[model samples]
Every structure is written in structure tokens, then in C-alpha cells.
Target: MDRKKFLKNGLLGLGTIVALPTAMNSCTKDDSIDATNDNATDGSNSSGSGDCTLSPSETAGPFPIKTPADLVRENIVGDRDGVAMLINITVQDQSEDCAPLAGVYVDLWHCDADGNYSEYGGTGMQSTNYTNVHFLRGRQTTDSNGQVSFISIFPGWYNGRAPHIHIEVLKTNGSSIRVTQIAFPKSICDTVYSTSAYKGTANMLNENDNVFSDSLEDNMADSVTGDTTNGYTLTKTIVV
Candidate 1:
């Protein structure tokens, strides 16, 4: 979708700042963890049925994480405040009958609770200045089950984009495999945004988002089971 040029032409000089909510000193224990969807099956494929398909390649958006190698940890929430979310991504190989592709590297990044990215802000695209901080960005290697999980806050929405998360898969040699995004269901998003930390609802929806409009439901996490009080768990399997 030529997202780079789109951001350069349409996002610059927007001069609109999304209101930031009060940040809590620390996330509550209940919200930070304890809500796990262990029985939720993988719903990342195009069809809801139990089958694997190659995840569509997507843009990294304008705010790609800087120095991902320096941010290797399971907990990506650094001083950000919102409903805690556990993102579980499973990587599979399409050539090998969608078997678990273990030992690969997964990089995941998303905006903070206030709809502001960590390392790139304080500019026309993002009004909040967070250049000095690194939050909601992390990299982890897949386990034997081809799964990598991150502890982060449920992301807040920006102007024209829906609530989503960016992910990049890399081989053992550090070469890129695919860049894609994870989408949240509208019901889940509405519920999360209604929380006190989120301040309000999103300005856009998944069907209307420029990136996810084109049959991107294949990347949507259908098994997001949890409440706003205890946090949520998003599980998706990406085939590459």
C-alpha cells in the first residue's frame, strides 16, 4: 500500500494530538497476568476452520522499532499504562505442512496506551515526544513449539488506524521472513477502549483501516478471551 509515502504525504503536519491518559506507576498483578486463554485454538488463517495459510505481508508502518536487537525480552511494557495483554504468536512453515518453525526470531512492537510509539514521536506524525524512551518494543526467539509471547498493554488507536500490532519474523541467520500485523476484533477493541486507561473508543475500525481492509482478517486473533479488569490474551499463528 506504499505506506511510507502515504505517511509522508498524509500523516505529516496533521497537528492533532490524541489525549494521553494518566500513567499508573505499575500494572496491577491481576491485570498484569493471571488471565490466560489456554484452550483457544489458532484462528489466524483466512478461514475459521483448522488449516494454515501463509500470512500476508504487510508494511511496518512509519514507526518501525529502532535497534530491536537491544530489546530482547518477554515483557515489552516499559512504564506504559493500560489493560495488560499477553500476545502469543506461533510461527509455522508453509513448505513443511505448517509444522512448527522453532528457533526463529520474532519482533513485535505497538503503540502505547496513548496511541504513541516509543522511539519515534514528538513530530508532525506523532505529537507526543517519546524519543528518549523505549516501550512496547521487544524481540524474542521462538520456543520449541514455535511460539513467542510478549507481555504488553492492549494498544490504543491512532487517527486513521485500527487497534493493531506489528510483527516481523526473522530466520536464525537474521534474514527477514515476513512482516505482518495482528488485528483485534471490533468487539474486543470496543470493550478495551471503554476502560479508564484507554480514555475513549477508537476513531477507526478494522474494515476501514487502510492496511487491514484487504481481506486481512486472516491475521485477526479470533480467540481474544478475557475481560477489561483482568486483561486479555491474544493468540495467533502465522504461517510463512
Candidate 2:
């Protein structure tokens, strides 16, 4: 395991892409009087076969399905470049109400169109720059039931908070993980949550971004409207 200790344990093995969407409501309903039943469309199937478990601080592994694209941009600098955010991702292992997980492997990344980080956290190119640089690196695997879609654009506003994307959830046991990251498209350029570094990361996320202030990480709340003069389509899902 030596190659600088296997890339420093494969860039600290990224904790399953920062721990799968921090459960805010992976699949739940009853929003008081309702915000249109939270956009009702339950086709859940992250496939763990329902009854969530192993989600408390699960450390997947020293990651090694593939590593060394400049350490995968120094271990995902918010997954640079290909950052122009236009999305429509989906996945489900099971939340009970409706299951639909089929053929998994859904990994994604972000940072660009000016929010920087196309290769090394920001300001793209390296590894000899040119046969050397590859911005916003990407990977998409999931179909039949679990889904994935991407079209790209609108991902600016950086340096502090608001506009985000970072996800990782693998299958084949190891507690059938649900590591997470998802949130972006904050009402055109009103600059999300306004001022003070996006209201201090949306007020320290209720107290802290602790696994994104859970409720089963709410199946990773995802949304990004269209008509940036026409060009946007991003989608995501994973529960297996």
C-alpha cells in the first residue's frame, strides 16, 4: 500500500463523498398544510430493502475503485470544472412508501462557470496542463430504476456558501451506504439566503452542517429550473 501510502489512503477516502445527502427527508410527506406535498413523486428504491440502518458515521473504506487523476483533483475539490450546474439526478434504495433502486453506481461533482475549482479546488489545469488538465471530472452509473441526468450551466457564487454539489453512495454491502451532498440553483442571482456569507451557510445549517442537518438527509433535496435562455437539466438519486 505504499505509493505515498496509496495516495494518503486514497485522499483520505473522501468518506463516501462526504456522507450521502445528510437525510432531511429521503422520503417523507406531510408538510403541514403542504408545499404541494413537497412536489409529490415518490418512486423510491435506493434498494436497501427499507428500514434505514448503518447510517450513523459509516466510514466506507480507503476508496479504490480508481484513483490518481491528480489524486482525483486532490480528492474532489468540490469536483471541479464541468461545474456549470444544470441537473436532474435521482436514486432510491428504499424509504418504504415506494421503492425503485436498480443497477447502482451514481457518483458526481462540481465547481466552475466561475465558482472556480476545475481541477484543484479552483482555477483549473495541472498535471502538466494540456494532455494534463480535465475540468470538473465526471462519472455516471445508474439506470432502469435508479436514475441520473446532467446537462450543465448556472453554478456560480463561491468563496463562502450557497450553490453546492458533492455526492457518494455505493452498493454491494458495507452497510449499503448513503454518503451525501446536494443543493444548488438558489433563485437566479439574488445570491442565495442573502449576505453574510449566505447567512452564515444558512445559519450554520440550523446549528451546523452536521450531515446536512438530517431528516434522513431528505433523499438529497434536488432542484434546478430551466430557461437560462434555454439550457439546464440536472437530476440525481441514490439509496442503495
Candidate 3:
């Protein structure tokens, strides 16, 4: 499918739509994998053993990256400040006995430490203006192991949503496969938010988030190991 058409179909197919509040502060409001046979935490198949099912499809907006092909890089931390984090995503083919699926492109983006997304802001929904800068956004292709890693700062939270990352998996031809969001563990969120860069408490938690509350078993990270002192690593597997 053409990228534009895919995005249009995705938006129209959503069962529920959450509205972002206008006049909200930039620091407020909201807001994987794999193949079968992988051991993932929280009963997911990322790091601990779990069922291999199709990852839940999610909405790609309020702010989806524009021209994602131009932002391909491993280090996506463009001037955003926060605790360093390494995001590792593995893609698997459920049809092939949960085997690794290599060469697919993964586009990932998230808000910075202030809860402000790049390429959007200075509006009623996001008070800070970041329209010209493209931070915290990048794309990379899965390797032979069907894994892609990104260097980013721990994301900050805003009102109405929890700290999360948005990812879209596409075939080499640019056709969309899955668009999903990943949730951070509350324990890790608490520790990351307490740091100087992300000083306030998150107004929303995974249990309270509209998108994650019901599908957290598959949406939440399999493991989030590390601390503010040494940075963190988030690993999850997505099966499609």
C-alpha cells in the first residue's frame, strides 16, 4: 500500500479515539514483539517465554513522523536531554514458527524528556514549539537477527498518557505491516522520572493509559534493566 493510503486506512480503522486536551503544558499527557518461543518478562515473548501471537495494532497519530526515510540513524537523541536509554526491538514471523524476520524497516519516535515531540508544538495541544527540529525520531532496518537498536533518552510523560514509544514496522517496499506503541514499566518510569531531566511524577500509569490498559500483556517491554546512573535498556519482540 502507498504510505499515505496506509496511514489513512489506519486512522479510519481505529475503534476508539482519544482526544488530546488543548492548552496543555508540553510536559503533560500521553502517549512488542516477537515471535513465538522467546522468553519475555510480564508474560511477553521478548525476554521470557510466552505465547507467539500477533502484536496488537495501535493508532499512529496525534504526531506521526513526516518523511521518516530522511531520519534514518541509530542514535536518535537529537539534542534531547534525559537519562540515556537503549531500545532493542526484535521482529519475528509468526507464520514461520516464530522465526526471526530480517530486513524489515522499523520507524521509532517518542517525546523528549519534556514530554514534547519533535516536529510538533507551539499549538494548543503541545505548548512548546518544536516545529523545526526533529528529535527522538529515526528509522533502521532489522539485521540478520531481526533486531534493531536505537540510542535515545528515556522519554518523559505528559498529562493523559504514560511514557511510551511509537513504532511502525514496514516492509522493504514501504508498505505498512504494524503500527504499535510500547509501554514502559512503572517501576522504571518512576526511577527515570525522578531524575533531574524528568523531574515530575507521571500523571498517568500503564494501568491508567487508555491504549495500554487493556493490551499491556503484549505492549509492555519484556525487560527494562539499568538505572538513571548507567542508563537503561528496553528489549521487546514483535510478531507480525
Q: Candidate 1's residue-wise lDDT over 42-113, tens digit each? A: 323332234666775777889988888999987777787887676768899887888999999999999987
Cα lDDT for residue 122, model 2?
24
* Candidate whose lDDT is highest: 3
Q: What ranking of all candidate models by TM-score puts the best one first?
A: 3, 1, 2
Candidate 3 shows a clash count of 18
* Model 3: CA > 4 A from native: 1-49
Order the numbered candidates by lDDT, best leading: 3, 1, 2
* Local distance difference test values of all predictions, in order: 0.72, 0.37, 0.74
For candidate 1, the C-alpha RMSD (Å) to the true structure equals 12.8
Candidate 3 TM-score, true structure as reference: 0.79
User: Each model's TM-score?
Assistant: 0.79, 0.29, 0.79
Which of the two candidates, 2 or 3, achieves a greater TM-score against the reference?
A: 3
Distance from true position, residue 124, model 3, in Å? Answer: 0.9
Q: How much lDDT does candidate 3 score? A: 0.74
Instruction: Show where candidate 2 strays beyond 4 Å.
Output: 1-7, 12-37, 40-74, 78-91, 94-103, 112-114, 117-132, 140-161, 166-181, 184-240
